[model samples]
Target: MAQVLFLGGLGRSGTTLVERLLGEIPGVCALGEVVHLWQRDLRDDERCGCGERFSACEFWRQVGKTAFDGWDNVDVERVQALRDAVERTRHIPRLASAAKPAVDVLEYASYYARIYQAAAEVSGAKLVVDSSKHSALAHVLRAAGDIDLRVVHVVRDARGVAYSWTKRVARPESDGTDEMTRYSPGRSALLWNAHNAAFGLLARRGVPVRRIRYEEFLADPRAGLIRLADFAGITLQPTDLDFLRPGHADLGVGHSAAGNPMRFTVGRLPLRRDDAWVRSLPAAQRRLVGAVCGPMLRAYGYPLNPQETR
Candidate 1:
């Protein structure tokens, strides 16, 4: 079995930057956002950290065609359709946990083993990083016995994520229909709640998990990278970080907004905590978030207004 690591968190929680940083380490191949659910709509020019779409990129094309034994033949639309059919048949929240007889643990494990072999052959790295960042997928992957699995559960403050979401909603190029459709602060707050809650619950279940806060990772990338490398049993070199920059030049987007490759660029951006939600969200929206996600906010260390939630 190959060494496989998963990055789990909600969308827009700095998973891409973490994946890119990990990709720089020798013996690591970070497959960005390989969530099978979105494989159908994934376009060639779609701006992934890899700088291309999951389907059209030469790297992924090879991974699907050769490494994973012709996953390229699986037909993205067909897979997505099956998933959609499943979702249609059940409540949406249960989509993550639903068992699929078509793509059970063995099939998934075999497919990913092929990917690991492919990645190892291409990069000469012994470990593969799958930054799909989905909790349900992580659960499934862990159940697969073909790989040595470890998890890095990354978390960011709810308000910061909400602010970023608000910005994306305004961007003509952003694919944030959910954010646009549900323009309320509670959405972000609830997202924060759902992801962190998922992470915590998963971690508590005896999975091999290392919790990493985005703020802390930003403060000390080298140390963080070193710790992650140590956990994955890989050696790190300074040159690998610099050389990998060209491959990652267009890497940052969505969650990886602060894409500067230099390790010390963490402080280049301000660390405004709650202002994005406070300043940008209307009073009504703030109340909405407080009303809905307030209990979760407090449980996760965010203080709430006295009147909003009990």
Candidate 2:
């Protein structure tokens, strides 16, 4: 079984940056958003974080061949249909309640198992980090019945998340035209609350999970990496992490199947906080986001009042 450190959370909560930091560790291989690999990598033939189109990327080409004999053998539509059927956020409740899932759900999970195991084998990694971000997918991975699954729930301020959703960021992995999806403040708030709550339930259900708040992680990312590495069962000496001493890291090359455009970034990346949302989110939307995410916001230790941005 593959030991997977699954990064689960609402989108736009800094999961990509965290994943990149973790990938720098020696024994961990980061597979960005394997949940989206079906549509984004295999179907659309998008660019990998390595800057190669999916078909041309030697890493994933090997992962496919190792898992399924070949990507050609994959039934993309069938997997996609199965995903829509049982892998949705709406299905989380029913999926979590049952020990056994329907035949189709099991079959959908089988693909995930193979790919993750194959990724482990192909990369010869001690741990595979999948930054899929959908808390619901963790349940599906659970159903796969053969993975050593662990979850790291990444939480960010709902207001910041809502504000990020309004930005018009381009998806570089695409044909250079399509942009990342943007959501209204209300919708983003609702999603933030729902996903965070779902991950909390995952912990109660006995899947080994550790929670990491994005703000605290960013405040001291070098320490953040050590804590994350410890949770994942890897130890790092101070020398192993010396690269981050300058308050930045020249990130190593990565081949995420899909994630924030930040996945494509490498070189001397500054470690700094992104509080743009704190300043730019309109007061009205801040209030609206606050109302929708009130319970979880306080639960996660965020101030109710979005104080004037510094």
List the global CA lDDT of all models.
0.57, 0.88
* TM-score, candidate number 2: 0.97
Candidate 2 per-residue lDDT, tens place, 105-161, comes to: 899989988998999999999889999998888988877678888899999989988
Among all windows of ten consecutive residues in candidate 1, which has the lowest summed lDDT? 255-264
Q: Estimate TM-scores for all models.
A: 0.70, 0.97
Candidate whose lDDT is highest: 2
